[model samples]
Target chain A: MIADYGYVGLFLVFGIIFVAGALAVSWFLRPRAPSPEKNSCYECGEVIKGGSWIQFNVRYYLIALIFVVFDVEILFLIPWAVIFRELGFVAFVEMVVFIGVLIAGLVYAWKKGALEWQ
Target chain B: MIIPVLTLIIMLIVGAVVLGFIAVSAMFLIWWERKVSAHIQTRYGPMRVGWHGALQSVADVIKLLLKENITPSGVDRLSWWLAPFFAVVPVVMVFVCIPFGNIFGIELIARDLNIGILYIMALTSICVLGIFMAGWGSNNKYSLLGGMRSAAQIVSYEIPLVLAMVTAVMFAGSLSMQKIVEAQKGLWFVFQPNMAIAFAIFIIAGTAEVNRTPFDIPEAESELVAGFHTEYSGMKFAMFFLGEYTNMFVISALAATLFLGGWSGPFLPPVIWFLIKTYGLVTFMMWIRWTLPRVRVDQLMGFAWKVLTPVSFANLIVAGWILMK
Candidate 1:
């Protein structure tokens, strides 16, 4: 297991280096031309107005919060799913109940209108 | 203690090979998608570069290389500089565990980690961070909106995606990619009713995860300019392209392995079988991309949270009940 992870680590290191190396090579070959207009953030050819960073919708955060709850729930289910067959009916029942609790949460989220996009 | 010299050398060789494969595969898929989309629309795609624009991607790469690398004013320097690397590197790292069948009795995978599927899920999830960074770093309104949309979209769809994979893992009784394939030797999982649902869910959620069309509201050009990558130019933009197409490949390959019986076939070599299945699914994705219109963001989120999640969870529970009995 340790050695398996070692290969993954090796790949991770190599991948970062490879991307960085490509960028460095491009830096040497590419031109260095710049102007204020060229450097401005893209806004479909209109004079830049207010700051681009504005307070956005809270719905994005709400959706993110709901996602976290379910994502964590799914993560917990994975290990159980891997060895599920071996554990048989009793374990299956246990998981059904576990999932039932989560379903309740989902239903509550639904009823509360947390899932609504508006 | 000393590093194993032969193993290190072998790994370096493998890394170089995989890197080459990623570059070539991305280029080919880009060309193929254009052709597929064009032919669907009843027009010829690129035909100038090489025999029907076969070398178009190569020329494009060169053009990008020679172009200036622009760092827009008022951008977050650190994240802006690193976003491309973040986008490309994690996707590249996922090539580590992908089983490419065998050649001459040697397994083509870099290392068959026991937690193969889990590892892939983890790595691919990191891709969202890169897009988010690019958007935030660019200090552009469209990029920010695109980034936020993607983060929300990917996270929402991931539940169904994971649920589908978990169903496969339950059947296989292992998380290793090779083991999952081996479990399907007698019959492909797609042949089963519940597994078929799982397969459908996987493909749908996988498409959304990669931010493809129909589910591609994140980069919906009609609304968000170029989306999270609006400020990206030249090679940095190319890296995002590489990451997107490569991601399409990875998701298709995973679908092939988990649902389609992987490289297993009687008449052909395993590698040939694997590529055929993977690319077939990829073509199916492209066909869908060109055929369907992009979904509205509210509908996209509603579909994931309301429709896919509930249906997939119910499928998983039902599949488990069948397995236990």
Candidate 2:
């Protein structure tokens, strides 16, 4: 188990150092100019208009929700994919059924305008 | 025994070296990208730094080292500081399963876990979270939007990517990178009809996974203005840049190992052949980045879930049926 997580630990250490080092270096080098204009949300030099936290399109949320379902299905496919040659005919049939259901969901999304570009 | 200890020590040293190599390669690749873009657009690239700007990365490194790292006044200090760490760690971890050569296999591989492919897939997902943290922690709206877009894009394409991987695994009959490579001794998986479809899906998904061109909606320079890491500067920004490039190499290397007969060749050392194939894939990725235009976020997501996911899933079923006979 320890062996399994060795890379995780290494990653943690390096990640901390990189972030900390960056923060530390920026503290001393960059000029400390913090005027309201300097800190304002950048808008390509246009005057700040609406709040930055305005409501985003709901389409993104719909897309993400559908994505999660398909993504999980894909995960299930990985284990099946690795063992498919050995599982053979039984696995092939099982996968087809699985994909058939997912495809139905995809078609539903398509019909409901979940995939339409706004 | 003593051999185990020696092996452990050797693995640690080699792992460190590989991490350093990846960092250096990413920096060089950045400079190369700049020079290539400049030449493409008919402008001189880094002529002031050194002859052909070979030493530009080194200069950039020095400058970043000297640059001041700032913590935003209202930001979450801990997560803000930790974002870069999270960004880079998984990129390094993915290298373990890469079969560089026979003698240089580094077999212990940080963890000789049986489910190497699954492990890598999980680790890569963790990267999206880090990007989210960086964007949110920065307290910058553009950064936040970039992060959200990245999360959606990565999560969406990951389906096709995993499906494509599954097709390969189904044909290879094992999840271990070494086993998969070994299975390809006679003929690489890419040549297999089903695997060819899987490979195409994998490459497209891989491109999106690394947030490269066409799929680079997260960091759309024209719109998001540097995207999720917009607020990051100095070495912190460098870490994100390095992580992104390293992840690119990792995905490419894994693709090579799975489909291109990793470390298997006649003329040169196994490691050299493996690296040659890996870099060849990387160059292909670079070519795509240079040539393509960024896809809109909605179109990107639609293409993945609507198009890629279905095709890849169908490909898997087809592959399974073909293998069964």
Candidate No. with top DockQ: 1
Q: Which ten residues in a row have the lowest lDDT in candidate 2 chain B?
A: B103-112
User: lDDT tens digits, residues B12-91, model 1?
Assistant: 89988999999999999999999999999999999999999999999999999888988988999999988888798999
Q: In candidate 1, which residue pairs get closer than 3 Å at backbone N, Cα or C atoms, i.e. clash?
A: none
Off by over 4 Å in 2: A11-37, A45-51, B1-8, B42-44, B76-78, B103-111
lDDT of 1 by residue, A57-78 (tens): 8888888888888888888889
Candidate lDDT (C-alpha), each: 0.91, 0.78
- On the 0 to 100 scale, the lDDT of residue B314 in model 1 is 97
Q: Pick the candidate with the highest lDDT.
A: 1
Docking class of 2: acceptable
Q: Which regions of candidate 1 fall more than 4 Å away from where they truly are?
A: B1-3
